[model samples]
Target: MTTARLDPDIVARLVGDAVTAPSMHNAQPWKFVFRRADDVMEVHGDAERAMTRADPHHRALHLGCAAALFNLRVSAARHGLRARVHLLPDDSQPWLLATAAIGGVPGEDQELAALHTALRRRHTSRFPFSDEPVPDALLDGLRSAARWEGCRLTVAGDWHLDTLLGLVRDAEHREDIDPLVRAETAAWVSPAHATSGERRDGMPAEVFGPRSSAGSSAVRDFGRDRSMADRGWAVFEERPQLALLGTPTDTRADWLRAGQALERVLLQATADGLATSMTSQPLEWPELRWTARDPLDAMGHVQMVLRLGYGPQGPGTPRRPVADVLEIRD
Candidate 1:
């Protein structure tokens, strides 16, 4: 019944909204294939764009792609449609993350639809935030957003925060020593793309924000040693308001759920007028990951470390043209 309505223009627009999702280094490591006959869109993770050293197991990649998946759901709901998803739908094709069968189940997902306004507004802010703490009430709403997506969002206390900060430093030290990791990260931070704006994807120099004069405890310093003119330094907040987004188990499926939950939390934060940034620096290392988790906390495994506060919104990163990542089949 809805097949006739799922035209190329509508599908293209939906995919365009989906690509606005944030990915690691803004790599935009995802692809969407729309099957007109079935009215389903296939989400695939692009191996060539994957951060080989940073995301060895592709866990972060899955989270990034899943974030895009969540945006697709939001777009569908906004258009009075529903996306029935099946994760890892094919055992034969590992990169084929999931497929969303679009059906016009209008009014069923008003909450997801409501997040549509925040889709473009949500950007990963890398600048310093004010010392003003986020309210407990607003934090609670963000927690609910994660819970609705079947994940846990834990606010880091003093001790936990210290541990997390240390881990970030440790990860930074490791990245400094590991040449592979540094090269991989540098590949995505494109200077030419920053000024020329020719490349469709990658984090440009301007979006790298300023250097953290506080020795980069709370945030990942992507500007490390890069002699980019006018990239000044700034002092970050004394105590960052950190949140841990976790899942019951660490698997491809769990990573997918984590991605959806991550975006939901981010979108909710944006809607609530909060500036946000996230770092997987600590979680990227297996040795540092387990230690980063609070032993007493019930969160089985941490999927992401997020910094939330009031601050200057980070400039938007580049994204692949919809034509570059989307394919339509008869």
Candidate 2:
């Protein structure tokens, strides 16, 4: 069958939607190269943007890039096209995370296309969530979303939730003493760096949310290193409703799959009128990450800890221009 020609404008639009995906510290560590000849778009992880101190193994980087890849698939489906994706398409080039050959009749992937509306709507909410518990039915749908992406999403039980919360605190304490980790986080969350308006990546002060009034919360505190004017403190939920996203194994391929699963669940939750945020703090520390997995549960390796509840969605952060991240080649 002859492949339909993917116009340059369509490719640009797809990439535009893809970059809206959340990344570690808003690093946006992915690049796309579209080849008109074969109608393929290659997603590559930007090594320079990788967090060497926190993400030494580049697992988080891979996850972020894969999330963008998932967004690309959703964008294609919304546009009445189908994205045939191959993860880690080239072993020789480890940075090449995936390649999507976009071309298909309209209305081919209705389910995926349905998520298109949530692409821009989804944001990482760091503000306080009300005490209202999420309905079991909604949680079940999120679990199914992860399963569709070859991963698992398990709602944390009371015991597991407490354990995970403690781990998050432990991770925060570790970052407090570790100069390198603290520096790395400060670099991303600094107002001076973000206020310049020249750089399009990294977490800005506007989305840092309020400081936890009482104590440590499930949300990652981006303002720990520096103080901001009018950054008032607020009481977070006493018992946060957390969910764990995991895979059967811990490998680059598994990380990529988990990332896609993460985005799927997030988008589904957003579409369902829920505010969501993710914390990889515990997962960043090896000891804490290992303990994060429930030995009795079927979920093997925990990849991310997500907070889902009723709250205000986070403000939109900046993203690199499509011209910077996407390159068109013959």
Return the top candidate by lDDT: 2
Candidate 1 lDDT for residue 94: 100
Give TM-scores for every candidate, taking all chains together and pairing residue i with residue i: 0.97, 0.97
Residue pairs in collision within model 1: none
Q: Model-by-model lDDT, in order? A: 0.90, 0.91
**Candidate 1: tens digits of C-alpha lDDT, residues 183-267:** 9998887765355868778878778778877676577777785887788889988789999999989989999999999999999
What C-alpha lDDT, on a 0 to 100 scale, does residue 194 get in candidate 1? Answer: 53
Model 2: per-residue Cα lDDT at residue 319: 88
Off by over 4 Å in 2: 1-4, 106-108, 192-196
lDDT of 2 by residue, 1-330 (tens): 445498888999999999999999998999999988888999999998989999999999999999999999999999989899898888899999999888867465789899999999999999999999999999999999999999999988999899999999999999999999988887777575455667788888888899998889999988877768778899999899999999999999999999999999999999999999997899999988989988899988999989999999988888899999999988
Each model's backbone clash number: 0, 0
